[model samples]
Every structure is written in structure tokens, then in C-alpha cells.
Target chain A: MSGYNEYFDKIKLNEEQHQAILDAVKKEEALLSQAAENTKQKSSDTAKIRFMRRAGLIASCAALLALVIIFPLGKRQSMTPANDKIPEADTVMSSDIRSEGADASLSGEKEVRTDAALSPQENIAADPGSIPAPAEEPVASIITDAVIPNTAKSDHAFPEESDRSAAPANEPYECEFAHSIEKSGEETGEEGPVLVEASVSDGLLIFNGKSYRYLEETITDESAFDAGCLAVITVGGDALLDPALLDIRSGMFLYGKEPYDRLYIRLSEDRFLCFVPEDN
Target chain B: MKTAEEMVSAYENMLYRAALSHTGNCEDAQDMVQETFIRWLTKRPVFESDEHEKAWLLRVVINLCRNYVSKKGNRGNAELLDIYPAADPEEQSLIEDVMSLPAKYRDVIYLFYYEGFSTKEIAEILNTRESTVRSQLLRARNMLKGRLEAEL
Candidate 1:
């Protein structure tokens, strides 16, 4: 091929094209070098991160999870003092009605008198203290009543006024929160209504698989709410009392604490079921 | 150690021209030049000598151009025809004629003659045997002689 050297030389690029490629090479070289330096800096920075920093990140995630488990929301967590985890019965249990032997049927089937268990009006006629044998019968009937809230509205079967076991009108709540079990005997709701599973969706709080819309701002973060403890709001001295909760909706939460506030159950950090007390 | 700038200066023209032989256009040729250097900077392969480094750059250029050519409907070098218009008609004819040769022969002829590579060096760059390169060179010369004689 070199026999015609001049002919092959003509195929070689001229000055301008040669210099143009050189200019492009210079431009690309600067970009590549900058990119390489950036990669080196990133690698060095990543290598310099301490092991303790990674450990601290993991520890933070663990702590967040632990806090999520401990606190029942909807009440003020930051404002409510940590020491108030356990509140006095009289201060929080104001205006509640208690019934003993309510869950005695869980022990075995009890023979309840259908006649005496008719209504709240009928239960008031008997001296409940004198008749312990037939009390389980009416209490079991109350459980049957609880199952059918969607069917018929009944006057609250507050344990008979004559029953000595009834807590004072001031003493209402039979607290059964999961947290209170280890600390004290407060969560032992021997006389409380059997709590059924309930969930909140949109504005309606679903209890006993029936939907009832709340009359007020009951839930803040609805996603955090699980099935709340089932309790009926019944008429008390001045306001409707949620028998499941203490009057002071403090460390835990309630849907409504105002008079005639119905169906207030707190399951989460900032969510509740607020129903109109008139509907109950 | 040669700086990246020094390497660019040393190999850019040869790589660009090598790319041009395959692409037959300046824009795609410049693209291959950039791609070859980018691979060199990122891969940072240690070279045994200047010949090894030059051969590596040329091989990358050839590979990049090969990919460009193999793409579907890639017969795109109309701009390359007018690039050397100021040259005399015979010089222009010769450049056009060389590019018009089959790619394998054109590559061997470019390395053997214009770039002044030995058959061994051309073989190393193309990743072929030196004897195969010599045969390719002879065939390319024979083909070029006949074609140019007819056209000129």
C-alpha cells in the first residue's frame, strides 16, 4: 500500500478536522476527570462514616417502634404527664354505673329469670343484694341485649339501684385498658359491660358490626385507630357517661367527655368514636 | 504516568480518524473519541507500554465504530463527502475511494499505510494475527488500485 504513499496521504485528515477532534477530546477529558473526582469523593465519604452512626440509626428506629406500642393515642401524650399512667378511681370514675356478675355466664350457663330480665324498669323492683342466685340470669340477658344494638334500642339496664354491688354514681368506670393490667387492679372490670369489637371508617364508628356516625370531631388520625373497647354511653347525673372510661379522659383518650356524649372509646394515640348520646 | 490530557492529545486524532474510517462522518467520529476516552478514564487499565496504551485506545475506537455501523439502516455519511472540498479532485477522489472500500480492508489499509502501523501493531489493535493483517493489506491495496484506476 505504501507504493502510492502520496495517494494514502490524501486520505489523512487536514489541519481543521484534526484540530476539531482535538478540541472535542479536551472538552470530554475535563468532564470525565470531574466525574472521576466526584466518584472518588463519594467513595471516601462513604468509607469515612463511623459504625456508631449506623448503630444509632438502627437504635432510633427501634425506639420509635417501642413508643408506638406503649401509648394509646387520641389523648394528649405530650401534655399528659407520664406519671399519670395510673389515675385515682374517684377522680376518673365519676358518673359511672357498675354491675357485678356481668361476666359470670363465661363461667357456665346460668338460669336467668326471663321475667325479671325484661327491662331496666323491671330490674329496679328487686333487692339485688338479697338475690345473688338470679342476678347472673339478668346479667346474661344483658349480654344478649348487647349483641342486638342494631335491632332495637333499649333503656340502659344499669345494675339495679337496690344492688349493693353498684358503684357510686360518682364511681363509673371499670377500666380495662391493656396497659393498666400490669400496674394495678384497675383494669379488672368485674362489673363492666362486655366490650365488643368496633372500628371507625369515614365519620361513622362501626360497633357490633353496625355503623353509627359521630356528631363531632372524634378521630384525628383514622389510620392509627383499631377496634375500640366497646362500651355504651348511658344517662347519668348531668351527662351521658361512657361506662368503659374514667370521667377524666386524660392519659388515654375518649371520643367525647361532654354531657350526653355517647359511645366514647379510645384505642389509638389520637382517634376516638364520638356518637350522639341521644341515639344510645 | 501520562496525564489524561496527554493521553487525549496522543490518541485523540488517531482514534477519531480510525472512527471516521468506519463512520465516514465527523460527528459520529467525535462521539467515538469521547466514548473511548470515557472508557479509558473509568476503567483505568494499567498499560505495559505506550504501544499497549495506543493499541487499547484504537481497539475501543474500532469497537465503538463497529457498534455504530451494525445498527439497523446505519448507512449515514452523506456529510463526509463534502468535508475535503478544498482538496484537488484527485486527493478528494482518493479519500472518498479509500472510505468506499470494504470496512475490514479499509481498516487494515488505514493502519498499515496512513497511520504507519506495522503489521504486528495493526494485528494487535484489531485483535488479529499479523499474517492475516498482511494478507488483508495486500488485498486492500489490489482492490484500491483497480477501483481508483477506473474512477480517476
Candidate 2:
């Protein structure tokens, strides 16, 4: 391409010049390799960070699940305690009345509560002859054929007098309560109602091998009863009968399994009326 | 497909020659080549073929040299023989004459004569029309011939 071919040949790189360019290229190559290595390291570090984030998310989910499972159990335990604070019995019949009527006075709570701790003799003096006449079929069946929802497992028990004696007042004791407070106090010649007397007349309603007799108590006090009818608690506190019309007065007998975890009334051979209390 | 070292080895001489045509000095040529490779490491552009890859390297070296020349603004300071200091005087004279030309003429001359790139290939490498490369080559050769004859 040039008339100066000889001249072009003369300026060709000598050994030293050739070596110098080669050395520079090699140096640049080394720097470039190091740069490549640094890039790989950066990518690897990013991947590790992503993995750690996933692991952290999983750990957070597990922690949330553990809290969900443990919280309810913890709350239920907090509601209860090692030592009992609740009354062993419901002589005030406040809960029974309260269920039947929302606006009933709490005065009965004070009256029964004072003598709640008293022995049978003291209970007789406190309100001797103060038994609300046991209406053959109370004036009105305030709580009739009322089947408490059976959502929870009932606190099961067989008839045990010791079980009913005294426990924490906060917890309701499901025990073998007597048939009628007045009738039991009468046998002892005491005036007012005390704890019910144990009767195994119709085979003990055995719960966990202990017998629980059905002590049916009806709250029919018109002023005290907002429903203006009667509310009867099945002896075992398993059933209540609330009749919409107070005039239709009929009592339902308690019948269930031997352990009596649930109570059922045989309406007939084919039909069965069953219920579970709310505070099981 | 090429490792960093392989790419450098494969393209270094060609890129060096193109950069030397642009800057006319060994130092600036080396700087251009190194800078081009540094860009390669950073940008890592995708290439369709080996020709595309080589064209990319050549383009980068040429651009870097062009930028170096404009920033330096002392194009005449480089005497080709003095830049490399060849052991042979005739080669020195010829290279000095080539370097003395304007960068546009020098690029055509280098790619056409020394590198044996066709007018069309040189045009593609320099991003110019083949006709422009042809005219530049003719002008470079005429200038070189006149200078050599006078020196003789």
C-alpha cells in the first residue's frame, strides 16, 4: 500500500519495545481478572443475603404460630388460680335467676352469701321457715326445656359430698348437691335451707364412679324472677326448663349415661330432649 | 466465551495498533488499550459473533485514543520513531511520516496498509463511509510519498 515498504520495515518494534507492550498487556490482564473476581464475590454476597432473609421470614412465622397456640391456654390459667376464690355453692340462686332474668336484684346474693359459710344450725336461725314453698310444679316454669348449648366439655363428677363442701368461690363446683335445701335442713330440725341432702334413691348418677343425685331447684319468686315464671336447675346443674307460657307447668326428669357427662330427658321412646349448660 | 486473559491476549496487538494510529505515542496508545479493556470488564457487552467482539474492542480503543488526543490537544508532540525509538532508521522515518499526518488520514493509512483491512472494513471499524475511507487513504499515501521523496 506504501511506496516505502523498506521504510515501514525499519520502524518495526525491536525486542525491547515488543516486550514492553506484552508486559503492559499482561498487567492489564491481571487487573481485569481481579476485577472479575470481585464481581463474583459481590453476586455471591447478594445471594447469601436473600437466603438469610427467607430463613428469617420462616422463623418469624413459627414464632407467631407458637404464640397463637400458647396464648389461650395462658389466658384460661390466668382466669383461674391455685387457691379457690369462688363460692362452693349457689345458695343466692343469683346465677339461675340471672340467666332467667337480666334485671333481678342482687340483694338475694347478700342474704344467702352471709350464711353460705355458716353451718346448718346457723343457716336455720338466719332464715328459719324461709323456704319458698316447693311448688308441686312451680307457679311458672321460668326455665323450662332449656337446653344449654353443648359446646364445651362439662366438668364431670360422681356424687361426692366432700367435693361440694367448699372450694374456691370463683369456680362452680359440679357435685352431688341435695334435692332441696329446706327438706335437708328439716331432718336436722334446722329452720332454713342448708346444703341439699344426698339421695341415691334412683341409682346414683355416677360420674367418674361417684354418684350425683338430681337436686332440682326452681326459682319462681315473681319479684326476684324477671321472667315472671319459674327457673329450675336440674339436680346436677345439667338442664333448665324455660316455658314461654308460665301456665304450662310440667317437670322434666333427668336421664343420661351412668357417668352423666350429659343429661337427657326421654320425651318419649322415640324422641329425646338433650342439653348442655353454658359454663361447662 | 472468552476469559479476561484470553480476550486481552487476542485483541491487545490489534487494539494497540489502532490506538497508536490515533494517539501517535506509545504511552497514550497503552493508556487507550488499557482503558478499553477496563471498559470491557465493567460493561461486559453482549456480542453476536467473534467479528462483533473484535469490532467492539477496536471501537473502544479508537474512541479512547480520540478522547485522549482531544484532551491532550498537543498532537504534534509525538514523533513516531521517538515514541517507540525503533532500532532501524528507515522504519523510524516511515513511521514518523505516518504519525505526522492528521489523525483522520493516519487511521485510514494504518487500517489499509499495516492492518490490511479493506476500505470497507476500515470504514466499518472507523464508523465512516467506505468512500470517505478511500479518499482518506489516497490522501495519506500521497502525503507519505511526497514526504519520503523529499527526504531522499
Candidate 3:
């Protein structure tokens, strides 16, 4: 053997050195085993979330059928010439509906309000089951809105017009949420720009091409069948998303992985929407 | 699959020795080994053989050490120095000589002499070309021989 080989051969490990090496290898093996277990656990949990989603959809469809029967009869009786003196009843009911809708949209509460304002004739002709069905077509139309235009040069012009239109006179304009009943709780507390209203047309929340935060709102506003739909939120619970800025046209998907994360949808000036893994 | 206890008894010492030579500290090396094992257990990718598993473990430990070193550098911390007990009176002098070598040379030499890794194996472990490993090994040998010869 060469002199270098002799020196290497002469080297010896003490008991402590030998013990340390064994410990490290054992630690690594244990870690790998644990990781495999975690993966199995996660896969099972994801399957459960998917099942719950399907059950929710079926329940909603059934509820819409019942609303058709109740709303028209109430509207006809409430609109009688003898009951015409009670205009306040209409206002009170609308406010109550707004409050109930707000509560439903704010949390994950279910709503099943049947608007009693529809004429009896209109109600008889309309299919309650199909009230929300028309909205589904708009979902397809919103997809093109998500496609960003090459506005690199015209970014200034668009933002200027958007901001000028939003300038407050005395009080901010009331946000008309499509399925909302109350203002966002965060909007009431903060000094920055607030989402006063969100308009729901079809299944999409139209925020007038502007950004607002849903710091206090839950994802997918209304829960029950034929209930007013609200803007769905996703992310760190503190931020808002700009609804109008999202190029949602008709049938655009609201939430997915990379598209949702990179959508630049800030519900509020300070908060941007985040994508949470459904499994989590 | 081996039981946790069997794995602990069989491989802990080897991993610790490898970690110690890489990091030059008992505590840091032990922590690195423990962390590597924890991560392995948590993120288990299937392995083909015992040898492959061993390589993967060693690779994780080494990468962890590199991260620690890089983080320390970012924080402006001093590099680790030699701290092992000398085997003899003459060996005490050799300790300073070996420890004073640059990290680039020290790593290959320690793996070759202490870990018993072949040049090609060391290169594979370090994710470097075999020619680079050979060149570094030659340079490390030449430097250590010169230092030992001078001491003699």
C-alpha cells in the first residue's frame, strides 16, 4: 500500500464515533417512513371533501323546487286591494330578506328565500328550479373576462378611468351584492376603500370592474338552493379581492390552483385572494 | 421494511460519523442526522435497496449541512474549526494542519480517509464531476503530505 493508504488504514473510530453514525442513519429511516404515512392520510381526507361538495349540490336542487310553490301565493295575497295600505310590509320584508341573505352570504349559512314581489301570473309561468339555471350560462361567458388584454401600454388609461369613476362624492356608493344582505363587517371597521355592494348576475359576483376585500366574508357566499349567490372568496382571511378587475365573463372557473393564486384579485387594497388546497 | 428500532441500532452511528466529519461538531451533526431522519419518515419516497436508502440519507444530511453553512455565512458567522481530540502528541499538531485546510480540500480528504468513500463515489455523493473529484483529491493529498512532511 502507498504511504497515503497506510495513513488512511491507520485511522480508527472510537465507540462514540461509531454510535453517532448509527444514530443518524436510524433517524433518516424513521423520517422517510413517517412521510409515507402522511401522504396516505392526506389522500383519504381529499376524497371526503369531494363527497361533501356533491351532497351540497343535490340538496340545493331540491330546495329550489319548494320555493316555486310558496312565493307566488304569498305575493298574490299580500298585494290585495285591502292589503294595499301596508306598503311598509314590503319594505320591512325586503330589509328582512336582505339581513337574512347577508347572514347567509357572510358565513356558510344556507338561504332559501322566495321573493314575494313577483306577480302571481309571472310566478305561475316561472320555474323556480330554473331561476338559477339561467345563471349557469353566464358562468361560461365570464371565462373570456379572465383573459388579460395586452394593456401594457394602456394600463395608465384604464386605471385612470377606473379610479375617476370610483371617486367618492360624500359617501361611498352602496355596493349591490347579488345575493348579499349586509355590508362586509371589515368594511364597517376599516378606513380604506370598502366593498359596499357586490352584484350577482348569473352565478358571478360583478364588482363593477373594481377590487374589494372580503376580509370578513367566507368563500361561496350563499349556500342554499335558489338563494342569492354572493362573491366567493379564497385566501388569507385578511384580504379582499377586486371583483370587477377579474375578467370573469360567463363560464370562467372561480377557483383553481395557479389561476386563482396568480389572478391578482385583491378583495381589498391590502388583501389579495389566496388559493387554499381543498384537501386542507 | 425495517422496524424503527432495528433501523436506529443499525445506521445511527454511521450517519453520525458522516455528519461529524462533514460538520466538525458532535451537536450540529447529531441534530442534522435527526432532522434528516424525521424528514425522511415524513416525506417517504420509495427506495429500491438498502444502498440506495443509505445514499439518500447521506445526501439529505450533506445537503442539510450545506444549508446550515450557507445560512451561517449569510449571517456573517465564522466558519467551524477543528474540535476533535487528537489521537497522540504528534497527531495534535496534525489536527491544526488538517483543520486549517480550505473547506474544498478538507471535504474530499475527510470523505476519503475517514468515510472510506472512493473518489468516484465521493463525486457522486457531492454531485460533482468525477474528474473534479480526482483533481480535488490530488490537491488535498498533496497539501496534507506537504504539511505533515514539514511537521516531521
Candidate 4:
């Protein structure tokens, strides 16, 4: 090993080679520092872009939150005055009807107008007997007033004392009037007779290519007849039944069940359009 | 830590010789030495002593020379023969014989003999087992002995 070391020791670089290495090292050092500076600048720019993106996202979220809080309050404030004007119009209409000399013979109608002027709960409590039974009341006039706005009567009818006493004692006065009043609230289009293909199966009423699930049988307490037909069946299914289909204006109380286990809609007194299921 | 200029001044010759021993080309050797000093500038490795610093520099130069030779393929013995033109005929022949050995044997022989490192130190420098260095050293010595004897 010592002898091999003596031979390798003689192998050395000359003066010219030494100068060449020093020159190369100086040039390489300058290039390395410039590259490091450029890398530092690029990293700082990337950090600024990331921060701005986060700030933009936060600002957009804040704006969306402000809209969500403000919109509902604005809608509720706008709706208040319109609701307050309805009772004022009803008072003005009752006054106009009373001024007509043609209605002077209608004392029963004057009582109904006075009752209509009262709030619903006060009218219900003050004289429960004043409300008319469904049979004694003309179904056409009620349907015309509630379902067809243009043909509505100028003098609303009220059943006389003799007619009220003649109606079955078990009959519900509120349910018949309440259903008609509820139908009146809807914005119905032109009234025309509609013939819809209908059937009932598994508690679903299928009519006009649409199926309605039986939400409930509306007359739960009374025997079916005293409630005036076998329940006012409400329409419930995947979608609402268009009220215009039967000139019913409202789908809620249009369906009735007779003694024959058939579904029928009353068009007027002594007239019912019955749905005979296809299977029958 | 030394500045890049100070490190170049201090360790360039030793690194250059070690690199030349592996590469067998003065230009490649000088390039390897410059690259090793550039690494010293960039890495800025902390060392316990000047001996530690020298060993680190030597390891980097040897690895650079190895990669340069591998990428360029095996350098010719004819080019290596010109490395020692100033020496006597017998000395030049001996130096050429050392350069002619495979790179692994040349590394062990040079580190163990010229650099005067122990087998343990050579193992650390080469990143190998000390026993492997001893065996390579034995094989290198036998080859050199056979070549020198045949020439005589």
C-alpha cells in the first residue's frame, strides 16, 4: 500500500489546470444566486394570489347572506296593506246592497248581510241557527257565486225560518257554508262542464290520467248522510287536481259518496254526475 | 463555514487530483472539482472539523467523477497515459497502470494509499462496508504487483 501511495503521489495537476477550475467556480456561483432569487420572487407572487382568492370567496358569501335576511322582511311589509283592504271592501259592498230599493222585501237576505259583516267566529257564536242547511240552499246560486264570479247573485240568499226547521236537525250548518266560502277564495277561470275519465282503487281516485290519494274521509264524527254525502273527500296525491276539470273551482269538497257506493259530484239540486268505476 | 472562494482555494487541488484519478481527464477532473465547490456553496453543510470538511469534499468530487465517466462511457487508457508526461519512464508506467484499473479498485487504492485513510474511513467516503474496501484493496494490490513484475 505504501509503495502504491508513492506512485499516486507523483500524479498531480499542473498550474494551468488550477487556474481553469477557479475561473469556472466564479462563473457558476453568480448563476446559482440569480436562480435562487427568481425562485423566491415566484413563491411570493403565488402566496398573494392564494390570499386574494380566499378574500373574494368570503366577500361573495357575505353578500348572499345579506340578501337571504332582507328579502322575506321586505315581502311581509308589502303584503300588510293589501290584507287590511279586504274587510273594507266587504263593508262597502254590504252598504251598496242595502241602498237598493229592489232588495227591501228580502229581510232574510238583510240578516245574512249583517251576519256576513261580522267576523267568522262572531257570526258562528252569535246565532248558530241563522246559518242555512245545504239542501234548502240552492246549489246553483252557491256554485255560481263561488265557482263562476261573473254570474254571482247581487242579493246573497239565506234560508227562511220554515226551511231551516225543515232541514234535518243533525245536519252541520258550518261545514256546508265553510266549504262554499273556501271554494270562493280560489281564482277560478271560465266555468264549463268537463267529462273526465275517473276510477277509484286502493283508496286512490284516478281522474283525467292523474291519481289522487285519499288523504282522509272528511266526515269522521257524524253518520255519513247527516254530514250531507259520504265525506267531502280532499284531493291528495303526487300533484294537485286542476279544479277547472269539473267546474268545481276547488278540489277539496267536490267529491261525495252516495248509498250505492258510487262517487258523484253534485252539479245542482236533484242532479248528480256519478262516476261508475270501469270495473263495475 | 468557508466562503465559496475560500473553499475553492483550500480544497480544489485535493479534489481535482481525486477526480482526475477517477475520470482520467484533466478537463473533466476540473469540472468535477468546480461542481463540488458549487454544492458546498448551495448545501452549506455543517462540519465538526476541517478533517470532516475535507472528507465531505472528497466524497462529492469522487461521486461527480463517477457520474461523468458513466455518462460518457469508459475513458480510454491512451488518454490516461498522457496524464504523467513529466515523470521518468518507470514512474509514468506505474501511474498509467494505476489509472488503467477499474474505477472501484482505483477508488479504494487511491483513498487507502494516497489519501492515507483507514479501511473504515474509506468505507464512510465510498458508502460501503469496511470489509468490502479491504477486499478491493487486496485485489488492487495483487493486480498492480503482477503488472509491475511482468514489466520488470
lDDT of each: 0.52, 0.52, 0.47, 0.55
Best by DockQ: 4
DockQ of candidates 1 onward, in order?
0.18, 0.10, 0.10, 0.32
Give the docking tier of candidate 3.
incorrect
TM-score of 2: 0.48
Query: How far out, in Å, is residue A275 in model 1?
Result: 54
**Docking quality class, candidate 1:** incorrect
Q: Per-residue CA lDDT of candidate 1, range A69-158, in tens?
A: 755552345324312322432223221222123333444644222131233223323433322232323432333332212211143332
Relative to the unseen true structure, what is the C-alpha lDDT of residue A163 in candidate 4, on a scale of 0 to 100? 46
Per residue, candidate 2 scores C-alpha lDDT tens digits across A224-257 of: 3222112233432323332111111112223221
Per-candidate count of clashing residue pairs (backbone under 3 Å): 9, 23, 65, 0
DockQ of 2: 0.10
- Please give the lDDT score at residue A251 for candidate 4: 29
Tens-digit lDDT track of model 3 for A100-190: 4465456654443434454323432453322211122232233233333232322222223344234221222222323222122232453
Arranged by lDDT, best first: 4, 1, 2, 3
Chain A TM-score vs. truth, each candidate: 0.20, 0.32, 0.21, 0.32
| Cα RMSD for predicted model 1 | 18.6
Q: What DockQ was computed for model 3?
A: 0.10
Evaluated at residue A132, the lDDT of candidate 1 is: 27
lDDT of candidate 1 over B40-71, digit per residue (tens): 87788999988788888888999888888888
What fraction of the native interface does candidate 2 get right in terms of contacts? 0.16
Candidate 3, superposed: residue stretches over 4 Å from native: A1-49, A59-280, B73-84
